[model samples]
Target chain A: MKDLDGLDLPTFEDVIAAHARIAPHIRRTPVLVSEALNALTGAELFFKCENFQEAGAFKVRGACNAVFGLDDEQAKLGVATHSSGNHALSLSYAAGRRGIPCTVVMPRTAPQAKKDAVIGYGGRIVECEPSTSSREATFARVQEETGAEFVHPYNDPRVIAGQGTCSRELAEQVEGLDAVIAPIGGGGMISGCCLTLSTIAPHIKIYAAEPEQADDAYRSFKAGHIIADDAPDTIADGLKVPLKDRTWHFVSNHVTDILTCSEQEIIDAMKLTFKRLRVVMEPSCAPPLAAILKNPEVFRGKRVGVIITGGNVDLDRLPWIKG
Target chain B: MKDLDGLDLPTFEDVIAAHARIAPHIRRTPVLVSEALNALTGAELFFKCENFQEAGAFKVRGACNAVFGLDDEQAKLGVATHSSGNHALSLSYAAGRRGIPCTVVMPRTAPQAKKDAVIGYGGRIVECEPSTSSREATFARVQEETGAEFVHPYNDPRVIAGQGTCSRELAEQVEGLDAVIAPIGGGGMISGCCLTLSTIAPHIKIYAAEPEQADDAYRSFKAGHIIADDAPDTIADGLKVPLKDRTWHFVSNHVTDILTCSEQEIIDAMKLTFKRLRVVMEPSCAPPLAAILKNPEVFRGKRVGVIITGGNVDLDRLPWIKG
Candidate 1:
């Protein structure tokens, strides 16, 4: 399925194939419910705990699909990506499982914990300046040297198809969900949800949540086209990226709405989830919950599914705690 | 069953009955596994996440059993306990569900987060000095004034029976576990494991893990009798209480060994678990994993079920971070 821009869009078939290809590698993460959260939101919320997923994020699903789907010759060439977050670790985890070489182009200023995680998964890190031009230049040189395939953090079709498997599992695990909301960064996760739900259950509304500090997706939704941002800042570090053409296709065509919440709201929601759901998740996973809490009128009396995107937090610098 | 110490010990049959009684009130928490942790320790570790329980701890199982088992006349009196930990909030959670009043006599210096949780769950708190004598004295006055039944934190057979249900579920969830380990704070959770595993899966050995700073349980195990500690201190606050007679009966008979770890080891294990397992657990839950890492010979090449006792820590004061 190719879009008007000639870029291929993933279909329901691709999602199904992704599920089968990655089933052996990825965990069918559990969906948990908290009565306390339900009471607070005035809506029953089912949390898809991808924080418990292999490599501690839903990104592993796509990473595994991409790595394992490679031809024998392509496998020998290895895989590469530019990410200073969960994707870097997740791709490393997937590549290691397949016994292939993995290279990550990470910003020199990325947290030591994240760098350690990628290396712990048998990944080699190449330092890059903390800028898009520097990252792309470094990544291109590394790819030329190693002949490694580039897997965009969220812009690739294989990754979107892989992410779609999460919603499929959620639909099977739960019945009669009225709406599903997920935090949108490059829109890989939310786009995946949009792809799967639009095909199998169009009645189920799909909503995207974003941090107010990085509201490019929300503005793009309002304007009905792609809107790219430059160096947006948010405590949700993973959500600072702008959506590319592939993800924007799903966001513009299928998503019902895009909601945004403030930095303080994101931190509060993250802490409430820690306190009530008793789960450890990152700030990127909080915006959907924050939006749900902030706009109760839209969610009241409905059964909502909230995707907890990842749990790669730096415990020493927890947002709510002072140094 | 009555022991020579003139105290009644809970049987496996009691565990079965307690399971049926509290099934509706508690969560059948998921058992999680981390390949990274397994590789690190050279053991197949299955973590039963009781931190995700209804009141954020396994204590809720016993609290529900005790609160719901009261006769009509006793029900009118409600329930009371003396503690500044999960027990206070758990009993309150169960009592609130049953529409009964719950009172807790807690040390004035207990963390504000814990006190807030108890009050949030509809449990009334009475402040006392941070000493056993003061706690007992305050508890007696509250019991006298309210006529509420005194539910000993871990000494009661009913409470022990409720705790046993956790292992029964573990035994059903995972097959052929060579051993089981849990932190022994007054031996409530360990006693419960002993009661259930000793009957249904006698081939499996039960081990108790304790912090060296509060090693009364470990010392008592070696001394061949109960050795009450006088105000021992540790980062693992939940394990500071000395084992009472009822818990000692189960620990002395069914436990294979008692393992102890340093305070630093507990902190390290807690942080490691938070990073690897992506779960928020209290310091109390880390001792078992710490002991497993410290004494790898006992657990290596064995299937081990580790009980993550609870996840009720104050996020603002995480042990690893400097204030």
Candidate 2:
């Protein structure tokens, strides 16, 4: 299997540059220290609350960086992408800020709240069946018809660099972090974390927390090969993506471990978040929390950082709690 | 009705002193800025997220201050209070930290979650009927039986000084705020807000937001007399307190305006808070937001500071959205 050596890995300097560019456009989301969570796991926990970021997700950092970094001509041509939810809303918001057009190819089964958010931000939506093949086909058709530049949610170099800015800020926000854990979907967030952490704090361990049902990244990392889910099913809608070649390379090279957590554990952690932290997080955003709770032996006594990547949960579809 | 004269009025210096003393015990809750809210209301809004504070509300600040400020004899007897919800949990949490026994007189109608939280924190409960007469009589009986020092929820000087810590932090967090707004319940929050603003930024205007259905403070401000609700009815369970003499005096002297918002407006603002800000705010916490939304012209083009006071909403009884 080919490694990430030939890929254009974002340098720490590049992430720093991206941070500066997006600083004016995005929020420096708060880093919260949870005493209750720390007491529960016996570890000092630093929660990077990207759930409070603009558009209610860290995807805004990447989306804003990608849209704002474009050349005048490319930006004028506008951008399009396919996403489950967070990335689409983020792209729409960023594009709206720049007065540029944004079109999103979303799954027909995507939450109505998310669909409304996309349209609310002036993004044209192209709905397709809930399958990778259909999403790719739909995105291709829309891109070809509209002559819009493709902004692959996690595959593009610019998007990866853009995502790396989150880790750059995290590394600066807290000190003495023994490890940083983030949920892996298509590996965009983990890849960005790896690139930034390796360059600045190379000794810090980087782990990926994946849902047990969608453990392709975990299997791929362990077997020294890229793996795809045969038929994925998880309540963590944001983490449904199968890894791409570029992201897989980065994960293969830099991520220290990939941890898997159960759906019940995810729900339990989401409830803890709502009860203690007062932030509503989707299932995917709870994986790192589940990992820390279930396997405290690994994270205990260490300064651990967890990224609460998004809080765009549909109130009507909240999996664990009933209204 | 006598006003808070120069001798009795709390100065910014007093709040600063109280803040310094209580800083170690209280959570320095973060200030979150919402671009989505800003665009919606055309005002730059700064949210002081006391919902994320320890004990799940700003009440802890006052509770801790009141509990810990007691002299050795007073501390030995422990403390007691009557509350609908947040204050009971806060007082319990504070008393627990001091290794002292605490009792809470609560209406039988208080939410189960709040009752559980009070017990979970080790506070003994003395349940009474929903009316003020019954609550006061029950509290008197409990106080006489146990010899526990009664800590009034809002009327006490120490509690008011403790609540002032929130605005002191806010004054430091956001510069040049044209005005500050907080939900008025027992008038503790607004009284403390007035004290802090009058002391630190005398030029900054202060507004009290109240539910129209339970507009005791609004009526009092308008009629130049204390107005107790003849039939208090609102979904904002936390803000149903009739004005106490001390709080009413402070508010009349320092508060610039007391505005009333309809129950529907409060419910709608709560929904927006859950959807956009991802914070689960109870209806009382939504009053300031309701004020901002209902009278956008008053706040438009201004830097407005809003205190999101608590997040003790029972998901099962969420009033705004139909299940």
> What's the lDDT for all of these models?
0.93, 0.85
Any runs in candidate 1 off by more than 4 Å, and if so which?
A: A1-5, B1-5
Candidate 1 residue lDDT tens string, B1-323:
55565777888889999999999999999999999899999999999999999888999999999999999789889899998899999999999999999999999999888898899999999999988789889988999999999898899989999999999999999999999999998999999999899899999999999999999999999999999988888999899999988898889999999999999999999999998898889999999999999999999999999999998888888888989
Q: Report DockQ per prediction, comma-separated.
A: 0.78, 0.52
Kindly list the per-residue Cα lDDT of model 1 for residues A1-323, writing each as its tens digit. Answer: 45666889999999999999999999999888998899999999999999999999999998998899898898898999999988999999999999999999999999898899999999999999988899999999999999998888899999999999999999988899999999999999999999999998899999999999999999989988878898899999889889899999899889999999999999999999988888889999999999999999999999999999998888887899989
Q: Output the number of the TM-score-best candidate.
A: 1
True interface contacts reproduced, per candidate? 0.71, 0.50
Candidate 2 CAPRI level? medium
| Stretches of candidate 2 exceeding 4 Å from the true structure | A1-6, A107-112, A127-134, A145-147, B1-9, B107-112, B127-134, B145-147, B321-323
Clashing pairs in 2: none
Residue A193, candidate 1: C-alpha displacement in angstroms? 0.1
Per-residue lDDT of model 2, residues B143-166, tens digit only? 898888887888877788899999
